[model samples]
Target chain A: MSSPATQPDFGSARPGGRTARTRAAVRDATLAELAAHGYRGLTVDGVAERSGVHRTTVYRRWGGVDGLVVDALDLAGEDGWQPPDTGGFAGDCRALAAEVHRSFADPAQGAASAAVVAASFQSPRAAEALRGFYADRNARSEVIVSRAVDRGELPAGTDAAAVVRAVVAPLFHRLFITREPLDAGVAEQAAEAAVAAALAGVFQLPSGA
Target chain B: MSSPATQPDFGSARPGGRTARTRAAVRDATLAELAAHGYRGLTVDGVAERSGVHRTTVYRRWGGVDGLVVDALDLAGEDGWQPPDTGGFAGDCRALAAEVHRSFADPAQGAASAAVVAASFQSPRAAEALRGFYADRNARSEVIVSRAVDRGELPAGTDAAAVVRAVVAPLFHRLFITREPLDAGVAEQAAEAAVAAALAGVFQLPSGA
Candidate 1:
């Protein structure tokens, strides 16, 4: 599952040194470029110039714009992000869904996130990175579902990953697929619907994998 | 809200004549090209050569690749499609969700539909066309929800469009956003989840718009 772009070899560079600094600079530049001009305007040269890295170094490291986009998204996983931890399952779901809205509503994160999503449609590397990113997130989110079952908020054996996906899928569908407008109301409804479905055992896993 | 690409002026050409034949040829050629190479490989010259239409005619009428993609999708609306008519609300929702999976599973339809969705990311005109297409579809699908209300399957004043979006959004999120696998089971689950939410009164709109 590993690609050359996403799993780059930082030869001869130690941690917190040249390799780390260069990665940060390029990552920031890619986000800025995506916010400014989107995926269509992102270029290897543009990133090199913006990040103050040599053009040759950028090309040798990233290969092309697709590489840059993929790596930038891969960088998102470095922060060890976690899902919300509200006391109740319903509140946790709402908070989780609200986070989806807040990301898109914020200009900086919205542009970069949206561009990464758009780029994934074109680049298999980017798509792979996206899948990995979400897969990690889904795994982490399973904790909430488990907690819900323990607290008797949901039935035992509810599919945790499926419940997490159901909680946020409508928001993404509006944001990226349908290009529809979103507000707090939309986020709340997505959460509420998911909670209701979970309560109804809509997320129970089948007999076996 | 109108764009030249989506709202093309089919000037002075009667139906089933030279203009109609040319449009059909170009549309078919576009779909074939997308199936083979995706949105990144699509080009006006390639389409023109494949369609056997004059290069100048293709350029003058379609403007460019984006125009061709938008128009190809716009043609989909001409079919006067309708939602499934399964008497039970749960059955109707399941059929509706099944349609989403079937579109992406069919060989010819899958490639073309995915390509058009990819193209929409780069072109506002294509995005506009997509929104219009789905808006029409969402409007049409509202009938099932209303029928459910009439049949006492769901509570009255349930937001029909919201329920329709909920029914299909999970499948789309899996197919497009997460790049995850989908199956017949996934489709039925999405339908069941939406019905559970709708029956629980999660989709009731606020007092005012």
Candidate 2:
């Protein structure tokens, strides 16, 4: 598959051997379908046609639309993504929050991201795949908190994942839940709130609990 | 018309005359359809049958499934919903967060609420209804911050709606975006984090900005 590489921030499956290329091709088609027509419009034949793979091969490999979405999510999780490293915890939080805004609110990428979220609501396997994908991301983001602890910037026991969640939650809430408008201050304010909470040790777990 | 009143925690339509009764029945049926089968399964005929209203009347009034959802959401906004008032700002934050957990995580109401959110993603009118609903809710919740300012518990310049957003954003993130598991600590810790941030004046907007 050609590495199309449309967007630079969000991960894309790397080009490799024939099998890997096929997988990447199928995943790319799946995401494009989702972005353009949403989950309800995805079909096995559609993906096969879009990917230029044989219909029988596509059906046998993916089983169905749910399978396609699940596999695409799994592939996405393995793409070696990392959080920003800004040296300072507050700065890192701001960078991470802004990144989320760009990834999920930007016109180029937000539609596909939103469609996947909507697909999860429609399919149990898609929801599970989404859960696993985010779990991997949360684990990867913990390095930001660990570095802060090492530099004496935050409490030793601060919950790294919780801090990450705080930094991005308001943006997600506005984008998905409340359907509110977002501006430049939305990301900055959310990051600042997370920084303040982390400084107060609000995320620190009780010892041995 | 009977004021079935299945759940008490989330608001129910208030007692009223015949017009209100018809509206309540249709709203209840619309919510039931959304809860049971989600937005995809809701239909004008289904709502009409479930509501015991004529199909002609349902079509004439609601137009279609999206219209049914929009009307239900509008009616829900009209219900007298208020945030918790537990005296202390911290206590109120805890209560408000817990209220969100109960309303959105409880199996009885969560499905319907989730369906509405999912519907907004699929329909422009539904999105508008969801926006209006949350805007009303956010405005109502501002009292929590205003009271805190009045009692000198938080800075006078604090953004009331911003504080409310902080209190519930994390819970919505976990429940919807990441599909993460929620426990008792989820709501309490979220409230604590928001309280810490608010106390630090992180939510205070610049003067005249």
Best by lDDT: 2
Candidate 2 lDDT over residue span B31-60, tens digit each: 888888888888888899999999999888
Report, to 2 decimal places, the DockQ of model 1: 0.78
Candidate with maximal TM-score: 2
lDDT of 2 by residue, A143-168 (tens): 99999999999979888889988888
Provide a comma-separated list of chain B TM-scores, one per candidate.
0.88, 0.92
Candidate lDDT values, in order:
0.79, 0.80
A1-209: candidate 1 lDDT, tens digit per residue: 11111111112122388788899789888878876887778888889999999989999999888888777766766654567778899998988887778767767667777877887887788889888877877787788899998998888889999999998899989987788999989989999999999999888877622
Error of 1 at B41 (Å): 2.7
Model 1 - which docking category? medium
